[model samples]
Target: MTEPNLPSGNDTDTNSSAIPGTAAAWERATLERLAMATLIEQRQARRWRNGIRIAWLVFVAAVAWFGWERGAAPADVSKPHTAVIEIKGEIAAGGDASAEQVVSSMRSAFEDSGTQAVVLLINSPGGSPVQAGIINDEIHRLKAKYHKPVYAVVEEMCASAAYYIASGADKIFVDKASIVGSIGVLMDGFGFTGLMDKLGVERRLMTAGENKGFLDPFSPQTEKQRAYAQTMLDQIHQQFIGVVKAGRGNRLKETPETFSGLFWTGQQAVEMGLVDQLGNLDYVAREVVKAEELVDYTRRDNVAERLVKRFGASIGEGSVHALKLAPSLR
Candidate 1:
């Protein structure tokens, strides 16, 4: 069939100036062209949107698959397979190495249908007492509930709060030279009363209660305040002793030297019954759990979080550097 071609606006008849058919044809063609242009724009927009949507979906699927693989890989390939989770920083609340991370990692390791055992690789000197206690309790709960062996393998240093956490494990392992055991609580601050006196400076601290300013470092500590602080420390110390005893069971040697707030090599620790075995992470993974592979369930940083952390850390470093470089006159 031949395509329709309407008369143009300039195609007026020479004999009759008024040609109704030609005018109608021009009007129809004009309307059709306008409609065609509108349709083309809509179609182009739909194509562009569809292309963008497809590209985004592909990107998401790729990222999701990568993450799933990381989390889904066989935790262990051996008959008594196990999952290993690492805790290698300060154990303060809200930080990246808090009790929250430890609990979440442990939960993931044990709750997984594939994980036959759970191992914690700890390499920390320790942090906040409250955070440590929370992690310890979480470990105990998970261990009892899942009926899976939970082991603590100390790498470099596991002291104080780290030791608190280790005491929850079914068995603890340490390297030959790894630092172990600082079963003590500590709080340190400065006392500048003499300096303030010599410099004619006043603390000017006003408190509602007399004991409220007990820990003010700039002022002299009264005997009453000192006694109170020591009592608090004693209570926490006793609690630490109890946890250590529970974890070590009848193997622990009860003596003043054991809880002397000192750290020793892993070899010394094994003799003192602080750790069950003297070995590194791999030794326990193969010999105890009999697992030849490791699958980490800890969530990786998202793009936004990574960018924010990177920029924030850079800015903080620059600020610290600037402060350090500033002139300090005596």
Candidate 2:
């Protein structure tokens, strides 16, 4: 009876009980692995979502910045009121320092509503009379159109035609170290008649008019030619004097020699009535315009455009510098 009662502890029933325990352990391990895999998936999903959100935010910010910069929108008048327009370099027909560029800048300055006044920062030796005239006329037009006061500031040097452009301003300012008042016209060339004679060179020029070859290097100048040239220069000089007088009004104290193509220091210019005030641009803006904030309505150049202009300027400066460095026989 005892033998047949039940299997012992090492019997099949006991082993079967151990099998269920092992199966339960395996199931627990499987469930733990599943939980770890789920946790990893969730973490990866959250990280991916955060990364996508950050990328989207960056894209939106870039778009907004570029839009504000490049879009055709209204002027941002968050700061000062007066607009500054620079008239730098030579006033020529085709150059960065050209009448057209100056005139365009003036026009844009007046066009902007935020521009309460204008400051023309002039630093030039001179170039073309016609170009200067165009700039002067545009300045006049803009001043009258906007009913805004225009102040001209001479930086280092404002000579000849450069002064012509500045003369149109309501008030001219100059610093103590600045040079002003080179109020005349010049056309220069060398006559090589003697050199050509020594070199056995013959003159071979065809002209229908007798005066066409008047200042030819190979020909000798006549009394009439000299007289005619003087008359022309005189006429141009008188025109310059008249314009300066008109623009400066009762402020100018002119003698026969004031407009005789003479330059003066800024201090001397103030004493001689060539400049209205002996002050810099900041002084003028602070006193006359009565504002510390200034706006430069100058159209900003893009990266590519700036690079091109600088490249051209560099090439120009390099060539001129190279020529100057070249040795000369004389």
Worst 10 residues of 2 by lDDT: 65-74
> What are the clash counts of all predictions, listed in order?
0, 1
lDDT score at residue 318, model 2, on the 0-100 scale: 75
Candidate 1 lDDT over 1-330, as tens digits, reads 997897665774543666776899999999999999999999999999999899668656655654433243353434345687777888887676688867777787777777777888889989888898898899889878988988899999999999998988988999899999888988789899999999999998766777777777887899988898989999999998988898889988767878878988999889988988887777887888787566665544555445456656876997888887564331
TM-scores for every predicted model? 0.70, 0.68
Query: When superposed on Cα atoms, how far off is each prediction in RMSD?
Result: 16.1, 19.8
lDDT of 2 by residue, 231-318 (tens): 9998888888888988999888878778778899999888888888787878877888886677665444444445456656876997
Clashing pairs in 1: none
Model 1 bad stretches (over 4 Å)? 1-80, 299-303, 306-330
